[model samples]
Target: MSDKIGAAEDPLPLRWLDHVATAMNVTGSSLILALMVLIGLDVAGRNLLGAPLPGVPEMVSLSIVAIVFLQSPQTLRAGRMPRSTALLDMLTKRSPRLAAAIEDVWDMIGIGVLATVAWATWPRLVRDWERGTFIGAIGDFTAPTWPVKATIVAGSVVLVLQFLARIWRRHRIPDGKAQ
Candidate 1:
């Protein structure tokens, strides 16, 4: 492991962002634990008796997306995103500035993509919220769909902000220490 445990490189702007992302991560983690408990109960119910949790599968399906999006911005912030960097790696030794520029370009693209998604999803979220749309058996075990859609919008906005923060942080890094 790298032996650098000092405060974040750009701590001020990111402090709030970090806290928000951490909160999102905690929320996602709690959901995961809840899912496990739910699945365990479901399995026990199925095996011990003939009845099982209604809409467990549906709940899981919805939660999977929520979990992924919830955790993604934090993952991106951590520099843990799984990206193929063969070209960037090669460029780093030969042309560090170029590599940094390319990385910035990628961040710009990411910002645009994320912004577009947030834009697109907002209307759907509003419609769902306004209409009180839901999923699963209507009267059996329905869950409000807006919350998940809102999560999507929130996650997308966080990612966009994170990408912007990354770009800002990148520029703040000294010329010789750009990484």
Candidate 2:
């Protein structure tokens, strides 16, 4: 009796969730591309002109975490996260519903884990924001740490939302097939 869970005709909330996920995913992707450009520029400046840009290390480290977290929600929602799916895939053929149920359980577990992480990081974010703590040297142009922490929280929250949305989706393994 089950039907497609997140059909195009779904209510507003699911659509809103999709919109936010897509936006965050796009931002994450853009950040990755920008990082590539920045690294290239830094290398060029360093090797060609012998003028290495300062604070790149700090930027790269912080951006990497933000990028992963940003894309995590969409990746998980689309069932694209790397994992051993052979067993569940085989089960899908035999019992799609059961496979889906098991998948749902995993999704719920992910939600719990990510949500806990976000909750735990909350205080750190507050401290960074209040203290205005930063990375890089005093004369090397320091970057604020709060943005990175906030991004991590944002990403975690987005991932949690995606996990819950996966439960609402009520699909099978999807295996690159579910929309």
Tell me how candidate 2 scores on lDDT.
Answer: 0.83
* Candidate 2 per-residue C-alpha lDDT over 109-141 given as tens digits, one digit per residue, 9 for 90 to 100: 999999999999999999999999999899876
lDDT of 1 by residue, 139-174 (tens): 789988898889999999998988887777666645
What are the lDDT figures for the candidates, one per model?
0.83, 0.83
Best of the candidates, TM-score = 1
In model 1, residue pairs whose N, Cα or C atoms come closer than 3 Å (at least 3 residues apart or on different chains), thus clashing, are none
Q: Best candidate, lDDT-wise? A: 1
How high is each candidate's TM-score?
Answer: 0.90, 0.89
Error of 2 at 113 (Å): 0.3
